[model samples]
Target: MLRGQRLGCLSIRKGGSVDTHVEAVLAELAALEDPRMRQVNERHGDDHGVNLTKLRGVAKARGTDHDLALRLWATDDTAARLVAILISRPKSFEASELDSMIREARAVKVHDWLVNYVVKKGPHAEELRVAWLDDPDPVVASAGWALTADVVAKRPELVDLPGLLRTIDAEMKAAPDREQWEMNSTLAAIGIHHPALRPQAIEIGERLEVLKDYPTPPGCTSPFAPIWIGEIVRRQSAG
Candidate 1:
């Protein structure tokens, strides 16, 4: 049977029951898949074929539905999980549950959305951040750095800027791609937000040369930390 036809066969019933809603959403997502979108997303290591804008529309229509979100996440479908993150109540998740979810979220977009939408807003963000920082798995460790970067950007007083720069100097160049990206982000965040440490952050970025030659499209900013830091600081000064 064709994939769409098979998905069409899912029993989507009316009313507010969790199973009914999940099946309905899955059906909606299956219908929204585009081959062109899949090709583009695959280039970025995301497996979903649904356009993110359309997926956000689906989530908007559903509003917040934590029970449905859990059911959708359990489906383990990338699009469904994205919708699940959209509809979830971040505070509703337990620390252990969030940790398990992050570890299981293998799709790049799924992991990204889960961290940005649910994990960051959850109360256990700091707890998970510290636990995952030195995790054996590089991907999990990347998430730890992502959370740490957020803290560095928003709550500088809570983190040790010099220590983070030292870690980035020591570890970023050799770290795996995902972890390295987040560590670089922390480096940029420190330089962008903390003038006192900006010089050291730029020095570390210059010394490492990570993403230095990254091909950035014309209008977008480069991910190289020194350039990223300089551009943002310039913008802040202009504003």
Candidate 2:
């Protein structure tokens, strides 16, 4: 069953046949934690073939072996492993383990696993992040801030948008300011997701001037801010 042919046997297109194959695949996948296999699965981009429900079952079968899941997942393509991790939601890992995975994975790729699964479900998400935000290490804090901003942009209601702007602003000000390019990149991501924050952000340009000088990267600029702001202002003036 290690070969691709066996995996094909595990594939079912529809109806009861699909259910049976999914069950078999989940069982096999749960038992097999070989990082090499995980890597091969990712290289082959077979994650799309996986049914989420079956992946959840496999994770459930694995029980509390979260570390095992992480190790196996680290070897796979980031996107596929992300889907697997979300399904598994494995618990009972040490704090160090999750933190290590977060740091490691964040650098390799800005995959959604950290935001969706780890931030949403992992036991140490809050604690680790709380510590991270105040970390003396700029690298750690910047990474934490970048991830936090990314997550918050998706669920703006989860945070006080104004407060976040201030927090990020304060951090940027207090830091040595060596990584202007990286900082702008992160800010651009925020702008893409939360148009409402743009006015406040654009205001920062008035004070720093550098913000205005920092032209948005070509082709990556978000229209959300311009569009939403225009509509709101237009309606207000009409009223």
Q: Which one wins on lDDT?
A: 1
**Model 1: per-residue Cα lDDT over 1-239, one tens digit each:** 00111111222332544466787888898999999999999998888899899999999999999977877877768899899899999999888788778787878989988889998998988988888898888988999999999999898777888998888999999999999999999999999999999999999999999999999999999999999999999999999
TM-score of model 2 vs. true structure: 0.43
Q: Check candidate 2 and list the clashing pairs.
A: none
Error of 1 at 16 (Å): 16
Number of the top-ranking candidate, with TM-score as the measure: 1
Candidate 1: C-alpha lDDT: 0.87
lDDT of each: 0.87, 0.48
Candidate 2's displacement at residue 20, Å, is 22
lDDT of 2 at 85: 65
Residues 71-162 of candidate 2 have per-residue lDDT tens digits of 44544444335434654553555556555554545322323345445654656555565556566655555545655655565655545667
